[model samples]
Target chain A: MNLSKKSKVFIYILLTAAAIYFLAPFAYMFFSTFKSEAEAIAYPPKFFPSQWHPENFIKAWTSQPFGTYLWNSILVTVLTTAGQVISCSLVAYGFARYEFKGKNILFMILLSTMMIPWDVTMIPQYMEFNLFGWINTLKPLIVPAWFGSAYYIFLMRQFLMGVPKDFEEAARIDGANAFQIYWKIFMPILKPSLILVGVLNMITVWNDYLGPLIFLQDRSKYTLALGLASFKGVHSTQIVPMLCITVVMIIPPIIIFIIAQKYIVEGTSGSIK
Target chain B: MNRKKFFRTATPYFFILPWVIGFLVFTIGPLIFSLIMSFFDWPLTADPKFIGLGNYIEMFTEDDQFRKSLVISLKYAAIFVPLNMIIALFLAMLITQPVRGVKVYRTIFYIPAVISGVAVSIIWGWILNSDYGILNYLLSLLGIEGPRWLVDPAWALMAVILASAFGVGTMMLIFYTDIKNISIDIYEAASLDGASVSKQFFSITLPMITPTILFNLITSIISSFQQVTLVMLLTGGGPLNSTYFYGLYTYNNAFKHHKMGYASANAWVMFIIILLLTALVFRSSSAWVFYETEAKNSGAKKKRKGGKEA
Candidate 1:
C-alpha cells in the first residue's frame, strides 16, 4: 500500500492520540500510587507526585491479609487453568475425532449453553454449594472449572477439528488406544491451544471479583480481586494505598497478556475465522 | 453386532463423561431447579413453601426496584451496544492501517480488557471523582465544569458505561482480524476505478465483514445484559438507585436479602428476555449478514486452494 506523506503523518498522529486515550487512566493510576493521600486528591489533580513514595506498596500489602489473598488467587488460578485445559481437551478430542450418534446435537447443545446467563444459574448453584458445605472456601471457584466451560470447550473443539486425522490413525496402527493417542500425540500437538486456554483462564480466574465475592464470605478465603474490592469499600478515602494495591492486583494479568498476546490475538482470529 | 456397536459408542462417552456429568449436575439440574424454585417462597434458612406464580406476580406488580433495575439495564444495553460497536469498528480499522508500531498500540488498547472487574471499577472510581478527579480537572481547563460522575445519579449510568466501554479491545481485535482477512485484490480493483478509501471501506470492507459484525453484536448484547461485577464494585447501584442493573438486583435478592425464590423468578425473566433478544438478532441477521463463501455459491476459490495443495 502507498500513502502520501501527509496521510502517513495523519495516521501516525491519530494512532498516537488513541493510544494515549486508552492508556491514560492506567498511567494515572500508576503515578498516583507514588503520591501521598492528600496530594493524590489535591485540587488541580497532579499527574505527577511532588514526592515519590514507593513504600505505599508495602503499606498497602500490610494493611490487609493480602498475602492470603495472593495465595488464594494463585491457588484458584492454577487449579482452574489446569482443570479447564484438561477437561476441555478431553471433551474437544471426543467431539473432534469420533463419529457417533447424537454428536451434532451434543455439539449444538454445548454451544447453546454458552448463551445461558450466569445469573440464571447463580441461585441454584449457590444453594447447591451451600448444601455441600462448599461456600466460603475456594471449592466453589476451583471445582467448577474441572467440568469444562462451554466457551473453552468450543474454542478447543474448533482448534482440534482442523488437526489432521492421519496421526491418530498411524498411532492406532501401532496398537495405541484412544486414551494413549490423546495423551501422547494430540496433547503435544495441542500445546498452542492449551496455552491459549490456560492464559485466558488464568486472566479470568485471577481477575474474577463476583465469584469470589458471592462464594467466599470470609476475608481469609478472599481472592485478590475480592480483597481489593473490600479494601475499596472500607478505605474509600485512602487513595494512595488503594491505588497501590490496585497496581499490585493488576500486574499478573497484564504481564500474562503481554507475554502470551500473540496466541491470544492470532488464536482468537483463527477460531472465529 | 450389538456388542460391537455398544463398545464403539461407549468409548467416546467415556472420554466425554466428565462434561456430560457436569452438564447434568451443574447446568441442566440447576436450570430446572431454579425454574421450579421460582414458583416457591424459598428462603435460605427456612423450608421452601409452594407459591405458584406468587413470586412472579409480586415482581411484576409490587416490586418497583425490579422494574427500575430492568429498565436501567436495558438503557445500559441501549447505549453500550451501539457505542461499543462503533468504537470497536473504528479502532479495528485504525490498527489495521499499515502504520508504524501498530502492534504495540493494539497491545496497549487490549491491556484494559485483561484487567477487568474490581480493578477497572476502582480505577474509574478515582478518575470520576467530582472534585479531585483528573477528568473534572481537565474539564475545568476549558472553563466547563464537569458533573459529579459516579456520585450524581444523572451521570452514574453514563460513568459506568464509559468504564465498561474501555474493554472494547476484544471486540476491536476480532474486527481487526476479520478486516485483515479481506482480499487485497478487491481494494486494488476499487482503486483502479478511482474509489476513495472511505468509499471502498463502506462499499467493499463493510459488506464483507457483516458476518463478524453480527457475531459481535449478539455477544455484546448478551454480555451487556449479564453485566454485574462492574456495577457492584463501581456504584453498588447507589445514588438513588440510578445504576441498579438487573443482574445486581438478582444477586442482591438471592444473596443479600436471601429471597431465593424471588431472585430465581427475576433470573428466569432475564433468561427468557435474553433468549428472545438473541433469536430476534439471529432472525434479523439474514437480511444483512453475508457469508462470502456460501452466498457466492461458487467453488472457484475452493478449486484454486485444492490446486495449490495438489
Candidate 2:
C-alpha cells in the first residue's frame, strides 16, 4: 500500500476538502453564536465575530428552561443506557448460551422486530401510554428500554456467541447458578460490549426528538432536542440564540462520541459481521 | 413435573422474560392494535366507528397529499440512497489509505454525525438562509446567485438532501471498517500479477466488501424512508409542500391532524413498501453480494469432489 508523494499529496487534498465540507457548518455556527443578532446575519457573513460575546450561551440558556431540559435529557439517557445494557445482556446471554425449545423462533422474532418501522406502532403506543396516563412524562421514553431493544439484544448476542462454551462450564461445575454465573462471570467479560450498548443508547436517547415531541406536552417535560426544536419554532428570527442552544445541545453527545470512539467502531463492525 | 425439572426447563425463558414481555406489551400488541385501528374510522377525540377498508380506500383514491408524499419519499430515496452510498464509500476508501493524520480527518468527518438532527437542521438553516446565509454570501463573492434554498420548490428537496448528507460519516465508517478488515495480502498478490490499483479495487476490494454494501444499502433505505427529523425541523415540509416527506405526512396525520386511523393506514402502507423493497433487494443481492461463507463452502465442495475422483 505504499504511495508516491504525488498520490499522498492528492489524498491529503481530498481529505482536507471532505473535512471542510463536514466541519465548516459547525465552525461557522460556533463562531456566529458569539455575534450580535444583526452582525450574525450581516451580508457577507463573518466567519469570526469582531467582538466575542460568550454571553450568548447564557442568554440562550435562560431564554428557555434549558437547565430543566438538560436534566431531563440526562435522566432519559442515563436510565435508558443502564436499562438497555443490563436487559440486553441478560436476553443475549439466554439466546447465546442456552439451548431452550423455541429459542430459534423467539430469536427470529426479535430480529424481525428491528425491521418494523416506528411509524406503524407509534399511534397505538401513544394510545396505550395515554391509557396508562404515562403521556407527558418521561416514563414513555425511559421505561421501554428496561425491557431491552431488539438491536442491542442482537448486538450483545453476537458478542456473547463468540465466547467458547467451555468458558462457562468451569463456573457451572462449581455449582454457580445460571443467574450467578451471568452476574459474576459474564457481566465482567461483557464490560466492553455493555459500554458499547450504553454509549449507543446514550447518544440516541440524548438526541431523540420524535419520542419527546410525541409523548411530552409541557415545556417542563422537554428533553434538550425537543427543547431546542421548540426554541426554533418560537423564535425563528432569533438565529444567534438558536445557534447558541444548538451548540449547547450538541456538546454532550460529541463529548461522549470522542471518548467512546473505539467501542463505537468495534460495535458497528461486530453487528455487521 | 418435578420442581427441579420444571425450574431447569424454565431457566432460559426466565432469562429472556424481559424481552418477551416487552415484545407483547410494546411491540406486538401495539402492532396488532394499529392494524385494527387502520380498519376503523378513529379520530383523536371522538369514539371510534368501524369502517373497514374506508381509510385505505380514501388514501389511494382521494388523498392527493398521500400520493404526493409517497412520491416525494420515493424520489428522495432514489436520489439519496445511491448518492450517499457513493460519498460514504469514497470517503471510506480515502480514510483507509495509509496516510498520516487520517484519524483526525476521520474524527472531523464523524463529528457532524454525532450531533443531533435538531442542531444539524439549525446550523444548516442559518448557513442556507436566503439573504444572510454564509453559503449564499460565499456564492455571491464568486459572482453567482444562490437560489433560495429553503424557499424555492425547485431547490427545497435538494436543500433537504444536502443537509441530510452531512451525516454520511456513519455509513462511511461502516464501509471503512469493512475495507480495513480486508487482508492486505490479496491486494499484494494482485499487485504481483501487475493489476493496477483500480483493477485491484474492482477485482478484490469491491467484491470483498459487497456484503457490507448490501448491509449499508438496506439500512440506508430503511433510514432514508424514516427521514422525518431533518425535514420536519429544516423545511417543515416547506413553501410548496415540496418536501412533505411521507414520514412527516404520517406524523402530521397522527399527531398534528389527529386522524389516528388514517395515519395508521399511512404507516401500514409505508411498512409494506419497505418490506417489498427489502425483499426485492435481498432477492437481487444473490447476484452481486459475495458472501465469505458461500465462497468457502464452494471451495470445500470442490476439494471433496476432487478427493472422491482420486
Candidate 3:
C-alpha cells in the first residue's frame, strides 16, 4: 500500500488526464449550446461563446413539442420502473423461496431468454403488438415490464437468496400467508435490489430509442429519445438548437446518476463479484 | 393429492404465473413466429404467403446492402471490442490505484455511461463534425489535419466506435470489482520478489481476472453486433452507406422498407451468428479462463482418488 511521492504524483496526473478526456465533451456541448449558428460552425471553433444565450434552451424546447416528449419519457420511465419492481419481486420471491417442480429447468429457461437478442423477436413482437392495437401507444413499451424481465428477476433472486429463511418461517408461523409474507416481510428486505432495478430501468426506459421508434407512429407520442432523433432530420442544419436540445435531453439521466450513483455502481460491482 | 396439498404445490406457480405468461406471449411466441415468418413473404398489408426459404435465398444472393452491413458490423466489432477492452482495463487500473480523489475521477469517467443513447450520438456527432469540431481543432493545433470524421466515408465507422468508446464505464467497473476481489497477498509477494508493477499485472492480476475478461469479451461482442441506436441516430447509415451497420440494415428493412419477412430472415441469421460466436468464445474459454475454485476442487478430488488407490 505504500507508494513513493513520484509514483503517487504520476498516478494522480494520469487519473486527472483521463477524467478530463471523459468530461471535455460534455463541457464542450454545454458551451456550444450558447453559441450562435455561425459561431458553432466558425472555421476556428470557439470553445467559449462570445455572447451568452440562455434562451436557446427555451427555443429548443418550444421548437418542437418537447413538453409532450418530456411528459411521455417521465410517464413511461416511472410506470415501467414501478412495474418491474412489483412484478419481478413477486416472481423472484417465488423462485427464491419455494422448492417447486421443475424449478431449476425453469430458472435456466429464464436465463436463456435473457440471451435471446431483441432483433430475433423484434419483428414478430411488432406484429403481435399490432394485432393487439398497442402499436403507436405506450402500451408496448410499458406493458411488458409488468410481467418482469429476466435480468431484474435474476438480480432480485440473487439478493433474496442471500437473506435467511428465518424471517419467512417466523412470518408463516404468525399465520401470514405467502402473499402477506412477500408483501410485509420480504419487500422491506428486498428494497435495495428493488431500488437498483428501478434506477437502472429508469435510465434504460428514459433513453430507449429503438423501442419507441418502431412502435410509436405519431410525433406527439414520441419519447425524448425519439424526439431528439427527429431533430437530426428536420433541423439538421441548425446546430445550435440541436446542441441545446441535446443538452436538455441529457440532464435528467445525469441528475439521477449523480443522485443514486452509489446504488448503480455498487449494484454492478456486486453482481460482477 | 388432496385440495390442501394441491394448493401448497400451486402457490409458487401462482406467484410466478405473470412471468410465465409474459415469457410465452412476448418471448417464446414471437421467437417461433419470427422463425416461421422468415420462410415466407409476410407482408404488413396483405395475408401471409408462404414462399419457403425464399427470403433467406434473397439475403445470400440478392441483397448487397445486407452483405456490406454485415462486413461493416464485423469490422466495427473487431476494432471496438479490443479497443474498448484495453481502455476499460486501463481506466479501471487507473482508478483503482492508490491515488487521492479517486472517487471523483471515477464518477467523471463514468458520466458518459449514464448519458442516453441519443444524447451520446448527438454530442459525438458535433464533436466529430468535419469543420467545426473540437477534435479537428485539437488535431490542427498539433499540425495534423483531421479527416472529416462523420462525413467522410473512410472515417464514419471509426467515428461511431470512438463515440461508443466513451461509455466503457460498465465494463471498467466490472474489471475494477474483480481486481478489488484479488487478494493483496499476491501483489505483496510479487513486490517482495522485486517484480515491477507491469510484471505483477501480467503474471498475477491478468490471470486472476481472466474469467471476468471472458465475460466482458462475449457480452461486448454480442452487443456490438446488436448496436443500432447510435448508428441510426448519428450516421443514419451515412455517406455512401459506410456506417450502415447490420442492426440498422435490419431495422430499415423492417420499418423503413416494410420488408418485414426479409428483415425476419436477416434477424434469424444474426441470431445464429451470435449463438455460434458465443459458443466459439465459450469453447475457447476453457484454455484461458482460470477458476481458482475449480483448481482447488480438482486438487481435492485427486488426493481422494490417490488415497483410495493406496
Candidate 4:
C-alpha cells in the first residue's frame, strides 16, 4: 500500500520506537553490567551506568571456576559439532544416494523423534547414567551428540538428495569407489551446510543450561551456562558484576549469531526443494 | 568382498552408528526404562522395588503437586502458544513490507530470538524487579501501581509468560520469511478487485500463512509445556507454590525429591497429552489449513514439493 509523506514519517517514528522498546533490555543489561550495586538498584532506574567499570567483567569471570567450565563447554561443543557433522553427513549420504531396506520406516521414526521432549527420558536416562557411573563427568553432555541428531541428519539428507546423480555416475565410471565419491565429491559440496549445522550445534550446546544442570554434579565440571547460572544464584542481588557476567556469557553467542545468520538464511533458504 | 560395495554399505552405518546407539541407549532405552520405572518404587540410592501402578495412582490421586503441575502446564501451553504465534506473525507482517532500513528492524526483532533462555530469564528477572525495575518505573509514570512480579503468587507465572512473549524472535523470523514468500502479484490482484489492504491481509495473507501458524502452534504447545528453565530460575516454583510449572515439578521429582518412578509417570502423562494434542493438529489440518497445492495435487511428489515451499 502506498502512503503519504506524513504517513511515512509516522511509520518511521513507530518503527524507531518499537526498535528501542525491543532493544532497550539489551542496552539496559549491558549498562547494568557497569554500574555499582547501589546505583543499579536506585530509584528511577538510571539509563546509563554511573561508572565505566569494565573490570566488573573481570571480577565476574574470576568469581567462579569459569575457566574450567569454559574449557569443558568448548570441548563438549567441539566434540558434539564434529560428531554431528561427520556422522550426519555419512547418514544423509546413505539416505540421499543409496537405497536400502527399511529406509523409509527408519527415516519416519527419526523424524517422529523430533517431537519428543528430552524430559520424557530424564528419569531413565538419569538411571542409565547413574548405572554407568558417568555422573559429574562431561560424557553424558557431549558423547551422545556424536550420534546423528535426527534434525541435523534430515537437514543434511535434504541437501545431499539435491546433489546431481550424474556426479556419482561419472565417479563410478572413473573407478572411484563410493567412499571416494562421497568424500571427494559430496563432502566438499556439503561444506557450507556442514558449517552451518556445526555452528548451530555450537550455539545450542553453548547456550544449553539444562543438560549440564541435569548431568554434572560438581561445580568444576560446569559449562559457561551452568557456571553463570550458579553465579547468578549466588549473587542475584549484586547488580553490576552479575550483569557483567551475564553479558560475558552471551557475547560469544551474539557475535557468532551475527556472523552465522547470513549463511543460515541464505544457504538453507536457497535449497527450497 | 568388493571395496566399493563395502564402503557404500559400511559408511552409512558408521555415520549413523552414533545415532543408532544413542537412539537405542539414550532415546529408546530410556523410554522403556521410564515405563518400567513408573511401576516401581525407585530411589536414586538403590534398586527400585516393583510397586505395580502405585506411582501412577499416587500422581493422579494423592500427589497435589502433580495434579497442580498438570493444570499449570496446560494453562501455560494454552496461553504461551497463541501469544507467541500471534505476536510473531504481527511483527513479521509489519516488517515484511519493502521499506527502507527494514533490515535494522528485522535484526532488532531477530536478536531476542537467538538470546538463550538462560540469559533471557536472568534479564527478565532483573527487568521485573519489584521496586527498582524499569517496568515499575514505567508503571509509576502512568499512576498505576506495579505488583511485585516474581514474588507474588498470582502474577508470577503471568509475568514469566509476558517475559517470553517479548522475545518471540524465532517464530517472528519464521513468519517474516513465510510472508516474504507470498508472491506480490497476489496483493496486486486483490487490490485490483477493490480489496483494501486490511481485506487483502485477512483474505490473502492469513489464509496463506495458516500452515506456518499451525506449525508454530503445535511446536509452541510442546515447548511451553517443556519450559522448565524460566520457572526454575525466576520463582523456583514460588513463595506459595502458585507458579510451579510441570517441567520444574518433573525436574524436582526426578532430581531433588528422589522420586524417579513417580517422575517417570508424570513425564509419560505429559507425553500422552503432547502426542494427543499434536495428533489432533495434524488430524484437523485438512479441514482448516488451506493447502493450495493439496487442493490440486493428483500425485504425491507434487504435494511433497508443495509442503517444502511452506
Candidate 5:
C-alpha cells in the first residue's frame, strides 16, 4: 500500500505519539527511581528528580537482600534457558527430521500438553515435588525446562524443519552419521530457533512469580519476581521506594527483549509451517 | 562404520533424552500421581487417607468458596480474553500501515508483553493503588471518586483484568505481523476489483488471519484460566473473594491451607474443565479456524482417527 507524502507524514506523527504513549511508563519508571518518596508521589507526578537519590538505588538494592535474590533469579533463568535450549532443540530435531516409531503419536501427545494450563497441573506437580523433597529449592523451577516445553519444542521443530534437510542429508551422505549431522549440520542451522526459544522462555522464567512463589519457600532463595511480591506483600502500605526496586526488577527482561526485537520478525514460525 | 550406523540410529533418542527425562519427572510423573492424589485425603505432613470421589463430591456439594472461585475465573476469562484480543487486534490494525519508524511503534507496544507477568503486576499494583496512585488521580480529574480498585469486591477482579489488558502488546505485534504478511497480490487484486480498504480487510485480511486469531483465542483462554501471580500479588483473592480465581484458590489450599489432596482434586477438576474446553475448541475449530492448508485435507486433522496430517 503506497502512501501519499501527506499520508506518510500523518502516519509518522501518529507513530511518534503512540511511541511516547507506550514509552511513558518506562520513562516514568527510570526517572522516578531517583525521586524522593514525596517527589515520587507528588501530584502531577514529577517527570524529573528534583534531587537525585542515588542512595535510593542502593536502598533499593539492600531494602531486602535483593542482591541474593538477583543472583538466584539469574542462576535459575540461565539454567532454565540452557536446559530448554538443549531439551527443546533435541526433541524438536527428533520430531522435525526423523520418521521414527511412535513419531506422530508422540508429537500429538506433546502438542496436546501445550494446551494443558499450568493451573490444572500446579497443585499436582507441587504435591509430587513435595514428596520428592524438591521444595525450598529451585529444582521445581529449573528442572521443568530440562524437559522441553511443548511450545518451545514446537517452535524449534518448525524452525529446524524449514532448514532445508539437504544440509543434514549431505552431511549424512558424506559419511557423517546422524549425531554428526545434528551437531555439525543442524545445530548451527537451529541458532535462530535457539535464540528465540531461549529469549522467550528466559522472559517467562525470569519474571515468573508463580514458579518461585510456589516452590521457593526459603526467603533467602527467592527469585526476583517472588522477592518483589514478598516485598510488596511486606511493605504493602508504604510502597513508595519499592517502586525503584520494581523498576530495576522489570528492566533486565525488557532490555533482553529490546535487543532481540529486530529478530522477532524473521519470516514465519518454525517446525509447524 | 558400525559405530557410525549405531550413532545414526541412536541420535534422535539421544537428542531427546533430557527432554524425555524432564517430561517424565516434571510432567507425566506428576500428572499421573496428582490424579491418584485427588482420591486420597493427603496433607503434606500426614499419611494419605483413601477417600475416593469424596473431594470431588465435596467440591460440588459443599464448597461455596470453590464454586465462587470457579465463577470468578469464568467471568475473568470471559471478559479478559475478549477485551485483550479486541484491543490488540484494533491496535494491530492501527499500526499495520506502511509508515516510517513503524518498527519503533511495534517495539514500543511489545515492551509490556516482554515484561514479566510478575513485574507488570507489581508496577500495576502501584499504579492502581487507591490512595495516591496514578489511576485514581486521573479519575479525580473528572471529579469522580474511584473505589479502592484492588480492595473493593466489585472492582478487584476487574482491576486485575485491567492491569492485564495493558500487556496486549504481544498479541498486537503478532496480529500486526500476520496482517502485514498478507500476500500483497491479494490486496492489489482486491483494490483492482473495486474493493475498498475496509472491504479488503474484512474479506482478505480477516479470513487469512483466522488461524492466528484462533491460536491467540485458545491460548488466551488457557492463560486466563491459569491466573495466579497478578491476583496473588495484587488482590490476593480480595476483599470478599471477588477476585478469588480458581487457580489462586487451589494454590491457597495446597500451600496455605495444607489441603494437598483437596487442592489436587481442585486441580484435577480444573484440568478436566480445560481438557473439555480444548476438546470443544478442537471440535469447533473445523468450522471457524481458516487454516490455509485445510482445503488440502478435506476432513482436517481433527476428523482423522489416529493422527491428522498437521
Candidate 6:
C-alpha cells in the first residue's frame, strides 16, 4: 500500500520515539557503569560519565563470589541445553512419526502439561529434591531437563510433523534400525530445530533466579542471577557496582540472541502456525 | 509374543520414554503430592498433621493477606493484560510498516526482552529512585514533580507496571509474525476498493489476526498472574503490602514464612482461578476469534467484497 509523505514522517517519528524508550535504559546503564558511584546517582543524572572507569567491571565481578556463580550458571545452561535438545527431539519424533494405540492420549497429556503452572508443583518439587538430597546441588536444575519439557517437545514435534511421511522409508528399507535412523538421519535433519531448542533453553536456564534462590543456600552454589539479586540486599546503597554487574550479566544472552535471531524467529512462527 | 514383535510394538514408547518418565516423576507425582499436602497442616521442619479442609477453610475465612494478595494480583492482571496487549499490538503494527530502518527499530524494541528479570528490576529500581534517579531529575527539568514511584503505595503498582511493560517486545514479535504471514494482496485489493488504511486494518488486519490476539491474551493472563521475580526483587511487596502479588505471597509463605500447608492452599486457589479464566476466555473466543478456514468458507458470502480469503 502507498503512503503519503506526511504519514511516512509521522510513522518515522513514532518509530524513533519507541526505539528511544526501549534503548534508553540500557544506554544509561552502560554509560553509568563507567562513572564513580557519586556521579552515577547525581541529582541531575548525566548521560555519559565524566570520566571512564573501566575498572568498575572488575570491582563488581569480585564484590561477591561471582566467578563461582558464573561457573554454576554455565554448568546449568550447557547441560540443560544439551539435555533439552536431545530429549525433546526424540520425544517429538515419536509423536510426529509413529502410529501407536496410546499415542493420541499421550500426546494430549504432553500438551496439557504446559498449562500446569510452576506454583502448583514447586513446593512438592522442593520436598522431593530435599528427599533425594539433591537440594543446593545443581541436580534440581539440571536433572529435570533430561526428561524433556512440554513446550520444547511440542515445538520440535511441530517441526518434525512437516516432514514427508515417507522421509524415513529409504533408511528403513536399507536395514537400518529405529535408533540408528533417529541418530544418523533424523538428527542431522533436525539441526535447526535442535539449535532453536538449545538456544531457548540456554537463555532460560542462564537467567533463572527462583530455582537457585530456593534450592541453593550457600553462596558458592549461586548462579549469576542469584548473585546479581543478592547485590540488592547486600549492596543496596551501592548503585554503580550493581549497575555494572547488571550490565555484565546481560551480555551472554544478548550475544546468543543476536547470533541465533533467525532460528528463534522461525521456530516461534513455526509453532504458532 | 516373539522378541522381534514385542520390540516393534514397544518401539514408539521407547522413543518417548523420557517424557513419560518425566511426566510421572516430575509433573504428576508433584501435582498429586501437592494436592495431598494442602489437606494437611504441614510445617517446614516437622511432621505434618492431617487436617482435612482446614487449610482451605482458614484461607477463605481467616487470612486477610490471602484476600489482599488475590485482589492485588487480579488488579494487576486487569490493568496489565489489556494495556500490554495494546502496546504489543501497536508496536507490532509499527514495525511491520514498509519504512526504512524499521529493522533497527524492531531489534531495539526487542532488546529489553532479552535481558533477565533480575537485571531489569535492578535497572528500573535505580532509575525510579526518588532522589537520585534520572527520571525524576529529567522531570525536574520540565518543572514537574514526579511521584515517588516505588515508595508510594499508590504509585508502586504503576511502577511495577512500567517495568514489566519493558518486556512487551516478545508479544509484539508474536503479533508481528502473524501479521507478516498475512498476504499483501488482500490489502492491495482493499486499497483499490477505496477503503482507507484504518478501515482496512479494522476489517482486514484486525479480523485476520484474532487467532494470534487470542493466543497472546491467554499466555499473558497466565504470565501476569505468575509475576513473582519482578515484584520480589523490585518492591519486595512494597511499603504497605500494596503490590504483594499472589505469586510472591505464595513464595514468601512457603519460603519466607514456611507455611507449607497454607501456601499449598493458596497455590490451589490460584490454579482454579487461572483454569476458570482460561476456560471462560476460550468459551468467549468462538464469538470473536476467526480462523482462516472459517473465513475461507463463509467470508465471501457474508460481506467485505475485497479480502474475503483472509
Question: How many times do residue backbones clash in model 5?
Answer: 5
Lowest-scoring 10 consecutive residues by lDDT in candidate 2 chain B?
B106-115
- Report interface Cα RMSD per prediction: 0.9, 0.8, 1.1, 2.2, 2.2, 0.9
Residue B109's lDDT within candidate 1 is: 83
Which 10-residue window of candidate 1 chain B scores lowest in summed lDDT?
A: B293-302
Off by over 4 Å in 6: B297-310
User: Candidate 6 deviates by what RMSD?
Assistant: 2.9
Off by over 4 Å in 3: B305-310
For every candidate, how close is chain A to the native chain A in TM-score?
Answer: 0.98, 0.99, 0.98, 0.93, 0.93, 0.98
**lDDT of the structure predicted as candidate 1:** 0.91
Docking class for candidate 1: high
My TM-score estimates for the predictions, one after another, are 0.97, 0.99, 0.98, 0.94, 0.92, 0.97
- Better model by TM-score, 2 or 6? 2
Instruction: Name the lDDT value of residue B198 in candidate 5.
Output: 84
Top model number, TM-score = 2
Per-residue lDDT of B26-88 in model 2, one digit per residue for the tens? 999999999999998999999999999999999999999999999999999999999999999
Quantify all predictions' global Cα lDDT against the true fold: 0.91, 0.93, 0.90, 0.82, 0.80, 0.92
> Which clashing pairs does model 4 show?
A147-B18, A147-B19
Candidate with the greatest DockQ versus the true structure: 2
Against the correct fold, how does model 4 do in TM-score? 0.94
lDDT of 4 by residue, A118-174 (tens): 778877887788789888899988778777788888888888777777768978899
Order of candidates by lDDT, top first? 2, 6, 1, 3, 4, 5
Residue-level lDDT of model 6, residues B128-222, one tens digit each, is 99988889988889999999999999999999999999999889989988898999999999899999989989999999999999999999999
Q: Each predicted complex: what DockQ?
A: 0.81, 0.88, 0.80, 0.58, 0.59, 0.81
Docking class for model 3 is: medium
Most accurate candidate by lDDT: 2
Any residue pairs clashing in model 1, and if so which? none
